[model samples]
Target: PRGLMSLKSFRDCAGEGMKAMMPANTILVLAWTISGVCRDLLQTPLFVKTMVADGGISGGLLPAIIFVVAGFLSFSTGTAWGTFGILIPIVVPVAQAVDPNLVLVCLSATLAGSVFGDHCSPISDTTILSSAGAGCAHLEHVSTQMLYACVVAASSTVGYVVSGLTHGSLLPGFASGLIFMVVTMLVLRQRNKQKDAAQA
Candidate 1:
């Protein structure tokens, strides 16, 4: 019986695998470095004190702000994991200092925003791979998905605002978001129907 794989074959396969993973590995390393630096900065008493003193990012606004920032960063970078690594460390300490009760809500917002960005970002690896796997044009896939992603994102932003304002109450935030999403979708569908009728 031939060996499971010849030595040369195995080496070539391993090399290819490493080459494929290089970009992801580089992003992970960079994200980790940024997180570490953020953690160190947060540890400084002066930094923490200053952040707490900054009245601009009050508890009522922190979740919405974090969500937007995390979403923007993840969209630009095209990697949710990197966004998580970069934002979580910074957001955690800041949230705790600003409002301990908001820590969990802020964390959830960060994760949700990162995922939302990754879902809609054209450059995201998952988005690219999904299009490739479906044998569709990448831009077409991005464009089609963007509309729904934007709707969800809008509703989520509202939910975050409500949750933050309510001091982390989950029900009101969730219900408001769900209702907003449903109404938005119904309106879009009706408008599309009217436009189609007019065209026909």
Candidate 2:
């Protein structure tokens, strides 16, 4: 009979929402802080040693390596922004030391990797919110998107590798990455068709 709730009910709902959100916010902050601190501590010394030893990492492979590391950090933290904060400092200085021209390429790879990892991570807020907004199950969305994300990640890894080798010349790398993605998609589509036919 009481279709509309009272103002007190609305206020109670709002209060509960705030209470639920507060802890989540706190945990995100803690996650960001810890990730940043640990990366800073390790990277500072690691970069120093890297610079002193063999003039740092090779430009051809460093971006790919940075991408992998950034991706891992983002995946584990479930926060791309936190991964960026943790990786930028290390990536920039190390990239500069390795090859000043490759800094942009390395930074781009780091950003791409962070985003890719966030999209793939089950715990990432963006992934959760996307599934919730789409009115679908979170695991279903994650499982469906994971394949596409991994394919893109593979293409990006190759692109970064080529860019690093080419002294930050991205055109060839971009073209190659695009070709790789297209070919991979076609192969996957064919495989899916075969699988469906077999099932039928």
Candidate 3:
């Protein structure tokens, strides 16, 4: 019935400040935050532990490896969101007690790892939907998506390292590093485009 913000002038509320910065996608961030809240609220600890079995918690590399295995299976199950629902509650509190300072770092690792698992799995719903939607064979979707997810996951690990060093702040920290990732992706895209153009 009503159009959403024909003018969308935020300067009326916060001077020219909001209009000058982050105007195009603040709503997207807000929507994501709301979704995160819903996910958190519905998260159940017992269910999480049920999904995460006891093993590597007893020793060194084992715990980390266990997380990796869990990440892979949960995601391959075609439900990263569900996998996260089953892991974060179990991971977060223990991670926080281990070191309050590294909370975000640990969370990012867990979340991103799960996404890595789910996105490339042949049976994953998104993977299936993507192939079906694009009119491509399912294996092609899985194959191509795997390459990008691996690269991004590698970048994300480096991002977590930088964010941890700087206390995960936006100013001269996480935000600045994001610019590097964006630039890297853009340059890669341009290179591919040029190669395609030359071949054409």
Candidate 4:
């Protein structure tokens, strides 16, 4: 299937092909879905209130909080897809009605934030899934993935300000940023290797 590959394994040159040199290096993921209702039941009510807060004070800023809370929930639950599903639709309509112009940016910010949290989170399902599939440790996957995603996310935030509307574009806004990021990472890696070789 040629599923996901790890940046650490790529940079470290752990093995020449799909097979990992160290079999125990990988994490194993559980494929069956967790019950979403059970998850909601377990989440902190105080935190939920904060995300879906109403009125003048906490009201308008709720989207920002939704992003943050969803992040924590996703991280712990290990499934960003599930967490985001719960929050996005709830936040969208409200944000749109409040300020049409700011809605896109706000929404991107929220999505970006959710991704940011999930990428770094030890328990995030993507982290676990990637690690399990890549034959890498969960932490290894999280650390490397976090750096890669953060670079693109920061860049995407800028792009959001410039081109984040129905006034424009398509998907893999995720993938495009990832390409520039890989190039930048490679350049940085080459520089470090050179420095290390010279010092050696």
- Best by the lDDT measure: 1
Q: Which tens-of-lDDT digit does each residue in 73-186 have in candidate 1? A: 999999999999898888887778777878999999999999989998999999999999999999999999998899999999999999888888899889989999999999
Ranking by lDDT: 1, 2, 3, 4
Which portions of model 4 miss their true places by more than 4 Å? 1-73, 161-194, 197-200
Clashing pairs in 2: none
Poorest 10 consecutive residues by lDDT, candidate 1: 41-50
Model 4, C-alpha of 194: deviation from truth (Å)? 6.5
Which lDDT values do the candidates have, in the order given?
A: 0.88, 0.82, 0.59, 0.55
Candidate 4 achieves a global lDDT of 0.55
Question: How far off is residue 171 in model 3, in Å?
Answer: 4.4
Using TM-score, give the best candidate's number. 1
- Tens-place lDDT per residue, model 2, 33-68, is 764675575557365437545776566888888889
TM-scores for all candidates: the values are: 0.88, 0.79, 0.52, 0.46
Q: Where in model 3 is the C-alpha error above 4 Å?
A: 1-73, 170-200
Output the better candidate (2/3) by TM-score: 2
Better of 1 and 2 by TM-score: 1
2 or 4, greater by TM-score: 2
Q: All predictions: root-mean-square deviation over Cα? A: 2.6, 4.6, 12.2, 12.2
Q: How good is model 1 by TM-score? A: 0.88
